[model samples]
Target: MKKGFILIEMAIVVAILGILLSISYINFTRLSVKSNVDSKADEIASMLRDTYENGNKEMNFKDYYIEIIKNGNSFEVSLISHKNSVRKTDLKDFELNIVGQTFESSPKYIYFSPNGEVFLSNEKIEEGYDYNIDDKKFSDIVIKKGEKISKKIHIDDMPLGNITVD
Candidate 1:
């Protein structure tokens, strides 16, 4: 009398476990990518805020790139580290995403009038005028998991003009 399954039955169970494990692994990888992208977006936003606060007023958007690299469970942002004034991390192949660009038809850049009010309809950069961080400089960068790595992030602010950044 046998109390256990046959060898053939055990082999079938092993195959089923293998399939399940593979599926779980694939799902985990996808989730990891989503998490990494979100973290990168938040980090970039913080950096922009800090730059704005430092009185670094420039009408032109500072072009920057975001790199995602493989190392371990955690991901890192690659850039020139200010303190060390050197490349922050030695990275392998990464997908570069563009961060800043000002469009003519877009209100991505807001100028301030002489009276300290935000010039609503002006398109040209005024002389001696600086960027007001309070004006809410927007970005259009988007990060996602899979083939589409980046896209313009848009937000609707109308009946007022929309807030957009890239």
Candidate 2:
């Protein structure tokens, strides 16, 4: 009686395993890309909220603004501060990348007043606004004075069509 499997049988088993692995790898790559984009969006929203909340604090409050700059496949988030010097200088400008994503339109700058209100440059964001990317409208970040800050992601034809951030 034979005590071991034939060479042909071993090769067939290995080939089957390889095929299954390749299929799984493809699916995982797609899911991961989607997740990265979603998380980056969330981070931007959260940063805006934090800046607003901390704007009124007396410890280190000095007019903070967020500037989004896009260059090809990468986007940068800049944290800028306006100092009341003799020259009215902009100080402490820090920038970071969005990673694997780019803005659909030109750069946008949002300012947070000392009273914790949202503003586009010097004017307040009285009505709601939509942040579009790649020519697709993803969500609306509403900024109404004397009301709670809220955000909603519109998933019309997005990659993750079922995702909604509230």
Candidate 3:
């Protein structure tokens, strides 16, 4: 009788272990994907900062494009290619939670300057950053001096593609 009771206890323990292992495996897979996406965002941010540093004064604003996308919990940043080619390496990085839906709107922008600034519509401005409050117009972000600069062009009509900034 004692042997029989021990055998039943072992069976129950094995079942619980199997359940725990399955849950852990599922969670691990999800976490891995989320981490990869987050890491990509960080890379993109760094590239933008570098671009601003390199060309705030010397290069033409038309030469570069910065694209940001908010998809649920994941985000992607990329540089618009010169020929409008969407190369995998051209994508800056993936970010997580850069913009929340609670905010007034989502912005996918390009920054012409090394300071990581872009020209956005007045209605899109929410908090922080600089803008013309009265007219709802935003001037280009300057690192030190104030100037009217243009950086973003809206192409929402185009679907998400190499040239599209949606």
In the range 23-75, model 2's lDDT, one tens digit per residue, is 99988976665555455556656555545444545423335546655455445
Instruction: Report the C-alpha lDDT of model 1 over 1-166, residue by residue, as the tens digit.
Output: 8698999999999999999999999889877765565555555444434323222333222222223343543334443222221223321233333244322332232222222222222243434546454433333445444584443434333322233433
lDDT of 3 by residue, 1-166 (tens): 3435577789999999999999999889766655544444344544454434444445544445555555554344555544252422322232222221121344455443223334333132223435332332122211111132111222221231111111
Q: Score residue 18 of candidate 3 by CA lDDT.
A: 100
Model 1: weakest 10-residue lDDT segment is: 79-88
List where candidate 2 sits over 4 angstroms from the true fold. 56-62, 83-106, 112-166
TM-score of each: 0.47, 0.50, 0.45
- Model 1, residue 118: displacement in angstroms? 13
Clash count for candidate 3 is 9
Q: Which stretches of candidate 1 lie over 4 Å from their true place?
A: 56-138, 148-166
Error of 2 at 161 (Å): 25
Candidates in order have lDDT scores of: 0.40, 0.44, 0.40
